[model samples]
Target chain A: MASPKILIIGGGPAGLSAAQDITDAGGEAILVEQEGFLGGTPKRLHYSLLAPDLKPVEEVLDPLIDSVQQSGARCMTGAKVESVNSGRNGFTVTISGGGKKVEEKVDAVVVATGFAHWDPHKKYEYAYGVYPDVIDFKDFEKMLSDGNIVRPSNGQVPRRVAWLLCVGSRDRQVGKFYCCRLGCAVSIKQAMEVRRINPAIDTYVYYMDIRTYGFWEDKLYWKSMEEFGVKYIRGRIGSINRGEDGRLIAMAEDTILQRPSEVPLDMVVLATGMEASEGTRETAAMLGLELEEHGFVKPLESDSMPVSTAVPGVFVCGTATGPKAIPDSITEGSAAAIKALNYVRKRSIKVQARA
Target chain B: MPIHEKNLIEKEDLLEKEKAVVDGVDVSGRWNTFIRERLLSDYHEDFVEEVKSLPGGRTVTNCWQCGTCTSGCCLHTDYGLREFNPRYFIYLAQIGNVDELKKYGDVIWRCISCNKCVERCPKGVKVEEVVHNIDEVLRRRGVTEDTPGSRWDRTYLDNIMATGVLDELGLTLKYVRAEKPEDFTRGFMARMAVKIIRNGNIRTGPIRRRTRGWKKMKKVAEDILERDGYASAK
Candidate 1:
């Protein structure tokens, strides 16, 4: 029997990992990335470090990028899956990119299209777009990567900085009820980075909860407070205004003290939550895959089979399924790849038995 | 203990008689002990707005009652004055529970104005100022009587107004005489004064000439105070 072909949409960490797994399992894999680059949000945002251990992001991503390159998986960057159609034997996926359309037959499909950061502007209380100093996590990561962590309004090293967590998640006003899982850890990591850059720089994290749930991540959260002295204030900010010095002034009731407090900060970093990417929604619709309320492709059963989608030959993984950290996404990527490979192997075995 | 855990049963609110009879039924001891049931029907819905109008009370509406201010407060941490919860007081003031707020009159003055609560408050509630604002509201509503803290505050302000600078020795003497006469020459105050005198920082005669432009400065201060509806020049 011919090598069973599997189409893995999204050339992100999940898609690349899945593709590498499929090729290793002796199944032909086709990885399609909509962007010109292979790496997804992390690469696009220039995330310099990973959380929990503060390892360089390149240490994790570089190997996956290299694996996808050397695994002989047919990789297509700048390609979009315009549509997908089910046939009697398998599935046909049409790709549109480079001013041309190409069609391919794959026995199975894996959707690994990840998420987009929630736009901080939607939460007007933060004065995100209106105030130059108010930036989102992605922008802060980029600024850190570029070594230009200064006030955007005046390019001065900010002495006082604040991180406002739950900018969009767990906010009923914004219609996002789910907690963006990685936000807390990411904020702590970034705050630690701020201290590393300048110990004199005062960093604060204003949060409803410090939800670094796992034991290791919880330790990192403590390290951020005890070692780095990143002050954690338990209150969600209500309003932000510009100070006379062009500093951002945040107003909130210090819930602990039950009194209104205002602090002048050089910059305010909104730890914006993750939302389903446009591609995830589009792909789910085109493939006729079930999507959860938040629009990520729904798994067959979240507990029992997280990587399997409702569709027989289709699988889902990573942030494309829901908000997850990089490690979980990679693990889900491999899980989805195994599911897809099994589907392909079963189909091939059936064909052989019929022959 | 958090402010919520504060003992609401005050001595004045308790009615206990060693021997008593009610409606020809013998009631005595435990049976005669009747503790007042605290009920709050008066909600100052606009109390939060009133406090917000004050200089440091503008952010009272932003408080979600998280208690971060109390946990981060230096006074609460160092002294564990559970009754000195800034957060709970803000809640009471926001809801306009004046009766409940009156109960906190004593420890409310214990705030040292360290601004740790201010620095750590995520909501930027201007905690120190909010505490002041709460006190101001209490003073206006006659919920709190003039305590030594308020007396000392008046003395300090009067000294500053008169001399355009803090007259530490004069203010201390006046404060001691007016507020705590018994402690005027006892304990910490006496020891500190002797140390100062020995250190030669204490001047013997009348205070040096008033700060430069004392008259002009006092006039400006009085004008502002009068405009703000505060008694000008005491």
Candidate 2:
């Protein structure tokens, strides 16, 4: 049998890892990315550090990008998977970008189309568009990458800073009810970075829950409190208004203290959550893949068979499924590759039979 | 606002060992005070379902316990009250902790219906109404005795019914006599009998009474005593 040709959608860490693994295992892989660059959100957003360890982004992301670029798999940057049609024995997928289209026949398809950072503008109460200082995590990370923490309005080091958690995710108003999963840990990490930059800055994190889950609980959440003196307030901000002093005024009820507080700060960072990317939604719809309430692609079985989809010869993984951290996405990428490879190897045993 | 400077958890929930020997090591003092696990025997599974049926309590099930209601609660923010938390009570109600709910009956009715909680609740939980429902549940179950507040209300209504006139002196006498004020001689004098029997200071537990208005006078007493010493307090 000719080695199976596998089509991987996306060119991020997940797609890169999927392509790398399939190529290493002697399977022909075709990786497609919508963006011209291979690196995904991290490169786009210029993320400085990965939390829990606070390791430099380059340390983790650069190597994966390099390996996939150098691998036997055919990498197609600035390309998109236009359509997927399941034929008699395999899938015929249409790839198009830059006004050119190519048709390819593949034994399996892996949808690693990752998520998008939720648009903070959906929450008008925060006044993100109005105030230059009220920035979201994407802007905040870019500022961090620039290596100077300053108020966007004045270009001076801020005396006071605040982070508003649960911006778009876990909110009914925005029709997003799932936890973004990365909001707490990332905000805590960012807060720690701010404190290291300037200890005098009165840093506060307004939150519903400091859900720095698993191993990150101690390293990110508690350490940010105990080590960095980052104040964690048990309340979400009700609103943000411009003060006469050019400071941003945040109104919130301090649930722990059971007191209403109006704190004025030079900079306000909104811990924005994630949602299914437009590409992810389009790909899921195009490929006839099931989607969850949050618009992320739903696997055939979430726990037992995570990578396989309802459509035979198609697999889904990473943040394409739901809100996930970087490492988990990479791990899912490899898992999806193995599942796709297995499906190709057992061409006689149809996954449709199991369905 | 009542300044509750103590915790009922320490008295009621915490179980301490005098000298705890944990795996051949003396993990006594701070480590010894372990919170005893609660029993589900007092848990009424249908209580939450029943509470949701009441008026203004339809949104009782909608609380995600984000603490938004309690955060903006006037009784807490303006009054500096740590107890009477909407989040705390809602959580307790969800888990069917009827025993715990009964203990807070006195102050559960203290909600002034500011609706700050209702306005700001992200989950659309009508918090003030839920609080009212909790108070109603406690009152209907007869778990708490007729509080002094209810007794006063009853006394005032009865005065109106009996004479249909506002007689302040008559109302005061009727209310006071019904309560039956006991003269225990004096403050220190009352404790003299127990102190003499013990031949030392009596080790009574904390008298955790909700000192509402008297707390203001107590602050004044504390300031004067701190500056002038216990002699001035005498």
Candidate 3:
């Protein structure tokens, strides 16, 4: 019998992992990414370090990219899924790239289209775009990678830096009511990194809650405070403005003390959250897949079949299903691949019986 | 309902109808409690800039209210004067909440200028100067009356202007006579005076002495006070 061909949307961690799984299981997999490169946000944003363990991001991502490359999966970069049509037998996915259109028929599809970083500018009070020194987590990651963690206004080393948590998440005003699960851990990790780089640089983290979730992350949160001496202020910043000297001034009520406080920082990092990627929405719409309230593809049963979507042969993993960390995304990707492989195999068996 | 809403509930704004019925409805439970809307239109918008203009207060606008100042405050800790919150008063002064600041006027003058808050301030806010500036602004605005500390300040300055040196005994007696007449009788001040007498730091009889550059020093100090808009410059 011929191997079942599967089309995996999004060339991110989840999509790459799913392709790896399908290809290893004797199935031909075609992976499509919108950007010109693979590795998704972790690569695009230059995330140098991962949370909980402080492992180099390359340690996790390099192997995944190598697997996707070595597995002989047809990897198409700079390609976008223009349309997806479901037929009696399978799916016809039309991908557009570099002024060329390619049509491919696949037995099953894995929609691992990941999430977009929530734009901090949506919450204008943070003065993210207005102030040069007020940056989001992606920009902070880039700064860390590039070793340019200086005030953009004057190119001076920031003596005091503050990380504001939940810039675009857990706030109904910005329409993001879900916690971007990794935001807290990522901020703690980044703050610790900043202290490690320069212990003289004063670091403060303003948060509603340090929602590190699990035990390992909880330890990391404490380590950030106890070991690194990174100050934790229990308050979401009310507003941020540029000081006269070009420093970013963040105003927040220290809820623990029940006092309104303002700190003039050389730089302010807004720990932005994750939202459904535009591609995720477009793919869901084209495939007639059910989207959750937040625009992620709704799984057939979240409690059991998290990888199975409403659309029969189309599955979702990683942030396509919702906001998740890299490890969780990889796990879901493999799970979705197994479900897709089973569906293709079962359908082929039925086709043979009919014949 | 929401946590943010819970934060918006100030103790003063909380209204509880203990036993009440409205239009045949017994709206007397926890649901009946209402938080008054906070409307802040009376803000002195340039208050932060105003405080920043004073000497040693250039970084008043730099405070991020980390409670470092309050935590390191000698008045707040040693004296256990919880109301002597340097962080809270700095916030009030920055926002120009004069009415709210008046509530803290009695304790604002208690800042010992120990410079501990200054040393501990991560943002480099001259907390001691900012506290004094707040007191100065409040006194200038007539929001608060002259506190015992303010009376002591006046006596200290007057002694310096007159003698070009601090007349410790004269200033202390004058300040106590004006502010705490009961203390003038020999409790804390009397015990200190006895110690000074035993240490040979006090003259038993009237002795004639003058500061060599009294006139020049007085003129310079008066000019500075006048330029800084102090009412006692004359």
Candidate 4:
């Protein structure tokens, strides 16, 4: 059977970048996206509040998305793959969507399916289910995009908005270790946005510690204080309860003050951590790929082995491997293409030798 | 160093000398050998082929034995015990050592079910659930042996069983009374004195009295004891 032009799983930054990479390397690649749209989480995120260098998701990913399209990379949106089986010649991919099960034969599979936000409902004490106003960063982003900061219960502009950090990430209880790598910065950015919009409103950021470990972090911190007047308290919110007025009252022992205080907030934004996407495990199995405990796809061993799985010809890129920035995803995507091309060429050489 | 003193197989063989006969058991899935041996001799070839047929199992077979899962294990660090590393456990599970798995009841129970090792493993092994499943199997076999934590666990369960819920005051009283009767007497006096100092009135009411469902709860506890399950020695 003739192998697929090329099959790239995931429609996000990583998948798109890999498609572009493959095209640039004079190979045909297909980009399969689970979601209806392309840009992934970055597109869903409100990046206007982020640093200047980190351009808006639309502006940043536009060129790459365009390049993939222009380069004749077939983009399949809303594709849910069920299984993958590799044979001596190529891989057989079975995808089910839109009342049809489509099977595609591909020479190599690049898993860049990315990661999902860890659900906060598992941490039952957070009252995520009972409380209407308790939400995560993704919810906050959508609310911010709607151009309103109103509580769902009262439909009133939130006077007191508490942004909670490390809701699911960095918690031993939930088994999610190794911080989500972006939640802290994202929380700070979101808090600044809220503060900028309504100076009269009370903005409190409850955090274990400000993990702005990146360069130019000091500038961001200072800007949050001087420009936006964001109040950052060093402590974790222990419990959340509903007030008589249907507002969320967050209780935390303010370590700096050495006193437990209850803050009645109109909204609580739980900055949840990222986890490997659901498809990752199944896809890893299908391709006979290796995964890290985090459920992210394991990367090739060295620079020379960029896209190769433990089993030859199977490859992985982007957040499929681990949590990575967009720039890194694009870089790895290109590197993966080069490696895939090399793998195919080598396999063909072996085939000729056997013949 | 001790594990390295002799070959692993020899060390295991010597350890087998201390193996106690399980009461009222006849047939096991594997024969009268240690877990490693039974796995290799009776089942290795067929099980390997079986797993290779499974996609998930195929990926499992690709493990290069880097020991990353074992090295990153929290259970190993916290308990200072390693009856089964995540890597070894997976290997055994693949080879079907269902009987010998009961030996890891304590270490397996202490898992806290954390996925830390799973997240850090470069090979993406499901370490938490695999250990948990083994623990479930052990639980079914009535092989629950208490570790060092058995004493406090028993006391806690006893307190809960006696009183529908926990009785902090009563629990402390009972635990202290059993462990240190003289100290408990002094503690009682100190508690009264502190309450008086704080101007808090000490109520002589029951610390934890039986509620409406107390009868049902007692019956349940009695049933649990007589269920042919292993209990820690008093």
- List model 4 lDDT by residue over A232-297, tens digit each: 666799899987778787877655434455757888999888888787777777777777776677
Clash count for each candidate, listed in order shown: 21, 0, 3, 6
* DockQ comparisons of all candidates to the true complex: 0.02, 0.02, 0.02, 0.01
Candidate 1: stretches off by over 4 Å: B1-234
Q: How many backbone clashes does candidate 2 have?
A: 0
Deviation (Å) of B226 in candidate 2 = 27
Which regions of candidate 4 fall more than 4 Å away from where they truly are?
A1-4, A44-54, A300-308, A352-355, B1-234
Best-fitting candidate, measured by lDDT? 1
TM-score of each: 0.64, 0.61, 0.63, 0.56
Which 10-residue window in model 3 chain A sums to the lowest lDDT? A254-263
The 0-to-1 C-alpha lDDT of every candidate, in the order given, reads: 0.82, 0.79, 0.82, 0.67
What does candidate 3's lDDT look like per residue over A193-299, in tens digits? 99899887878788887788877544677677546756666778899877677776677776744656666778888888888988888888888988888868899
Order of models, best TM-score first: 1, 3, 2, 4
Which candidate number has the best TM-score?
1
Ranked by lDDT from best down, the candidates are 1, 3, 2, 4
CAPRI grade of model 4: incorrect
* B64-85 per-residue lDDT for model 3 (tens digits): 5679888877888888888799
Candidate 2 at residue A247, lDDT? 88
Cα lDDT tens digits, model 1, B1-234, are: 233633546778788898889899988887787766454322344566667666566766556567899998877878887778898888777656687788899878778888888888776678888887788778867778877667767788888887786767888778877767664566778798889889988764364447897777788889887765457765
